[model samples]
Target: MAGSQGPLVLGPMLRYIGETDATVWVETAEPGVVTVKADGREWRAPTFSVMGHHYALVVVDGLAPGDELPYAVRFGDVVVWPLADSRFPPPRIRTIDRSRPTRLLFGSCRTSVPHDREGNSSNGVDALRALALALADGEEAWPDVVAFLGDQVYADATSEAMRDFIAERRDITQPPGEEIKDYEEYAHLYGLAWSDEAIRWLLSTLPSCMIFDDHDIRDDWNTSWTWQEEINQTSWWHERLMGGLSAYWVYQHLGNLPPAELARDEVYAQVLAAGSGDGAEGSGIDLTEPVFDLSRRVDRHPEVYRWSYRRELGDCRLVVVDSRAARVLDPDRRSMLDPDEMAWLDEQLTGDVEHLFIGTSLPFLLPPGLHDFEAIDEVLAQGAHGRLVAAAAERARQTIDLEHWAAFNEGFAEVFDMVIDVARGNRGRAPSTVLFLSGDVHNSYVAEVTDAAARHGAQSRIVQAVCSPIRNPMPRVVRVLMSAFARSLVRPMHFIAARSRRVPDPAFPWLVTDGPWFDNCLAEATIQGPDVAIVWRGGEVRDGDDLHPVLTTVGAVRIPGGLDDGARAGESAADGRPTVAR
Candidate 1:
């Protein structure tokens, strides 16, 4: 058994790549020492057990900056990765280069389904797959890192494959039937989501970071106090919450940390100390109790664990905030972030960097009309109208997903103030751009804060860049409704919002300058010195090939640095649509 190399169950994913070190995460079929050999150097880490799943994060250090080298994964004496029949080239790890500008690929809300004609027709092409194929074929420039904003897997809205797995395990008619109920189910769900060969290879080569959104736990996960009360009543909510968080720790959150921070993590330390013994069955440590206990503590008191992290790439700072679990749900003091998380975010929003990227799963700036509508819903739900109206408002809020930053008025205002201050050089030397990178509305757009408002004609360019649905496409009717809200209804909504005594005037007015494009797409943001350029791309099938789709540019825009009002807000076009400011 010790000599036998077990099949890799999930990953050989490259995560947390830094200037001179990188970590590789993997899941093995059995408890074993995972080895990574790159550039004539080898590093090994023993697998730790999470429930019955065996995994390891091998930290490779002492490499020089800008070193790009092919790597291989090994279990015992046998090679388990870069499979003999694989079509892609050997996966390589590229260390950070301080001189080069930062290029980041980002998007959210992907559903795992067949990549055939039927799935493509229903969900549009898989933009991520297209990116991977392009990179594998040496057709596009490689991003330094990829940030998946949210919904890496939909625990609430299961696909047919997930539902079938659920049916196999439990009664389909029962409560939480199709929804994932425990760690095992979540593990299976992740397997389905990441097992695609092309994507697997992409993950193996590309450094990636992720944060969870509503669907990772459930839809409208912590939308309000009422939402919590309702969900807490369900028989399976405890197990589901515990399971979801534990799995998130094992799968997504673990990779977000660099070696130093990861070493300081209490849960990781405990797991490492506990140790999974050998590749033999029944020899591994069972982490269910400790892991679930940690999850329960987190769910009960979100302040106990923070999911947010900040990374400095060259002169750019990328702060990925956990807008979900760390929420303050008291209706009287509703906030997207709790006090501690907000304070942490405050520290991260400084302007010393040339570009500051604030990544939240939910968009910080919504379309103007939708922002007003959501704000109105929040106010009404808090009894701005009356008790009867408030009750109805709460129901409507959950039903239609009016739970973005706008719904948490206080938090939204505070963060907006922070951005304004940073843009105005109050925090540090004002960065050239203070940008919010987000997803989760099933559409994509670029919104710039109106210069005449609270922008105060600041030196920095403040913009919201949104991309969503790396695969899942919104229905046509919903697309039409979104377009109308994004463009046509802005004036009316603003007028209505101005009349609401309970809703304070927005810190600034903004407009969607580029898109409300409802494509299954991804967005790439490149920061060169002080200037920032954004491009959205989607996959398009050619020659009746369902699996091999080519990436087509959907939109492109640039935010000029050291802005003068007359300085051109750059423009670009794709699919015969204007995608930037005039």
Candidate 2:
């Protein structure tokens, strides 16, 4: 590797990886020639500027599948990797081998704080940092890929350090000053989130993907048409929405695309056309105006833009949905996914695989009791009773996030039927395990759904595995409130709520078999030939020179296939066994 590159401002983060192609993203103090060298090949790309921020994505191609390669990042004559790499067995990444089963690591809601005494005491421990420490200590096995479910950063909940930076630059006395105001602020937020030594190394060597939740933009963003109407009236919301979505594109979403898809990106092509003369110092046609407009257009008309994507891993298919931006918030016809988005999801739901993983930031299947409560709230909020009742319900709904899948009954039914068809082998050959990997609601738990309909040969085990609050826990009061709410949904209340819609019973009934663990945690999903097992683990800081994060198992469950249509859930252990559905 060359000499130390002028201190990397952000990442050597490994992004998308195909059988023969890979993408690496980075940010530096000032833009310069960025290069990646590995497997006896070299790839060079120049950084582009957006509102004075410099970024580069170097795509390496022509690599064989399962190729084990040591890669280095160089900015001009400075080596930005190798020395900064992790001191573990597999320091470099090995490309994906399509023949192997998919092992995915996932979680959400992480706060970026220092890994020292003061930081830990203030914000608790960051599970992401903990995972990084586990990797540093050789205490965890590397997975094939990582998925950040959502809320990767909280624009509404700024830390003291973030506030301090905001105060230093602009007037803290002004409106919308405490929270993030624009793309520049978002860049700083991402820098704080990704700059830690251990996590940086882990990200540099792992293939990763991400989606944004409410907090990533602002609390209760796009929750309802009413909420949208209110927010749009605010003076600062327009700029804030543009900033949040645009920053997401540049930071998280852009890297998720493969080489062909990235080339097809209209904005990327536009930027390239305007940036032909730039020599990595960001001396080209400015991109601020066009990029910002593009972002705004995406929010204004999400149907014109496509943010959802699907990828096939070995015999398993991974579908990551954009549950936020692509929403239809009509009061009479609210849906988490618009019709176009639903069509896209319908196309992706077909199965001829052993395992199918659906990644949504919000859990599709919450506890049956909790799901009933949200559905009831939505009905009341939609004027099922009266205007006054509707008004009160709306307040409660927004206050407590009664805007998940169950709240959007139409959308929920669509999703349920899609999964049911795939499970029943209506699309293609039925998959063995239909797993929904999600993280939201600030706790970890898993539930399993048993289809009541007749099965086609092999019945799929539908399950929802939730891991949340990688660093952010619900405040004690909120936790108590949620618990009380979950417990108070007795049989009579839930029955009344479910009957209010006069709809037929669900295709499957599910149960929470594992936990609602409220600790900073990460989760792993292991898929065998026809079985899928998931485990949630919390992070405990161990005493040492470095704040070492020790992983502790919170809960684990295995959902197996090969069950007959008449088969029932088996009595088994909480770790990796089947449990009866509610």
Candidate 3:
């Protein structure tokens, strides 16, 4: 809020960066003309409202690939960014240049903790802040884009700041008081998440894409039908669901679409039609009712609106999946994604690119043992066991968050086939590698399919990379449980469960090659030609300035491109196994 002389509150943050165009999304203090000026050009978009909150998505046109555009926003001559005479550099937007190497920074599960002694001591260093400072060292080899895989902010897990705001607004003694209650509270939550100076500058400059996981609304969101039924009976659930989805559309999802898609957005078109100034020449009309209605419908029937988005960044393609929202929750046919969403994903899940990056907030590839555990849990919960055992299985499943791809056997089979088919070159000129970029379990690791014959069948290398909790580290007890799960004999149990349920074995046998790093971390990917490389880094305060966390290597992996046929037949995952740090 330093640049408070103007109406802008949270952004001028760049989004949806493409070859010829870019989007700058902002939250304003009032509804009025919101403009983005850059490279001696501008695109004016009027501020639109949802339940009294104001926002604008300004689309800037006429740029070439690899264009370095430094943009600023204004509301009626009031400059809202860079503050007058500020020493900080102007926020920049670097469009994707396909000819150049593609680098993406991804991580998830962040809490807005204060960058001080207490927060660091409790939750470890804020890795995203460390990444910003790391990039500040030089322009050399900076990421072209950053994909926030999931849980960019914890709506369910409130920070002290968010708690304070809630305490001020409502009685803390009331039920569900600490969690976000409405769209207004969600707005405040976002402000808290984005206000840190270093992170703010980083967001304003970096072309960021986001997908939400459980904590974005609540932990274990959409985990199961039973859990959903229990939560729906709560008094505040309706308001919370409505606010989270509505605020998400304005703050996160709207910017995910391209200009052509944005043009097709009916609500957005309404705002565009609104005049660009005060009262918009009598066209300044409130759009609260329509916006709220849309939010409600999307929350109740997520299948109606597609939140999943894809970006073709040069030779690398990034597909961000809406795993949490688009669920087919029938007891008999449970799926993480409904049929339509799965079909849409199938279309995007292809070859032809040097690297195919699948961005599911929840890792599509879990540890083999955990994968089986979930599968077994699903089977038992579905009454493969006795009725009493089935009820117990359901309770345990909700408690441990065993609601991943393996739990939805049908959906898992679909994606497994899709990945295998794409890798086998059935879809197109197979990508040199197919990498699943994900975060959600609050740990970082690398896993790859190890089925030798499957590798022989695949023309492209397939791997899973995960980075989680950029700020919110898992508790010690949970870490112990995760480690135990990683080392369990659930594989044999899973084999039995799959047999009992008549579920086929996975198309590819997989193993976790690198790590299960529990530190707050961020991961980066670099794709050059047929070779793709990934590294996970965490932040540690090992110096005099305890505030600025130092970046430390967690683990790294390298997958060579052009695995066409049996080039890497003997090797399981990449070169031997993934290189481990610790």
Q: What ranges in model 2 sit over 4 Å off?
A: 1-7, 84-91, 271-285, 451-458, 480-490, 502-507, 544-546, 569-582
List TM-score per model, in order.
0.94, 0.93, 0.94
TM-score for candidate 2 = 0.93
A best-first ranking of the candidates according to their TM-score comes to 1, 3, 2
Output the better candidate (2/3) by lDDT. Answer: 3
lDDT (Cα, 0-100) at 532 in candidate 3: 77
Top candidate when judged by lDDT against the true structure:
1
- Give a tens-digit lDDT track for model 2, residues 316-388: 8889999998888998888899999999999999878888899999999886777877888888888878999
Clashes of each: 0, 2, 1
- Model 3 C-alpha lDDT versus the unseen true structure: 0.80
RMSD of every prediction: 3.6, 3.3, 2.9
For candidate 3, which ten residues in a row score worst on lDDT?
Answer: 276-285
For each candidate, the alpha-carbon lDDT, in order, equals 0.85, 0.78, 0.80
Let me know the TM-score candidate 1 reaches against the reference structure.
Answer: 0.94
Indicate whether candidate 1 or candidate 3 has the larger lDDT. 1
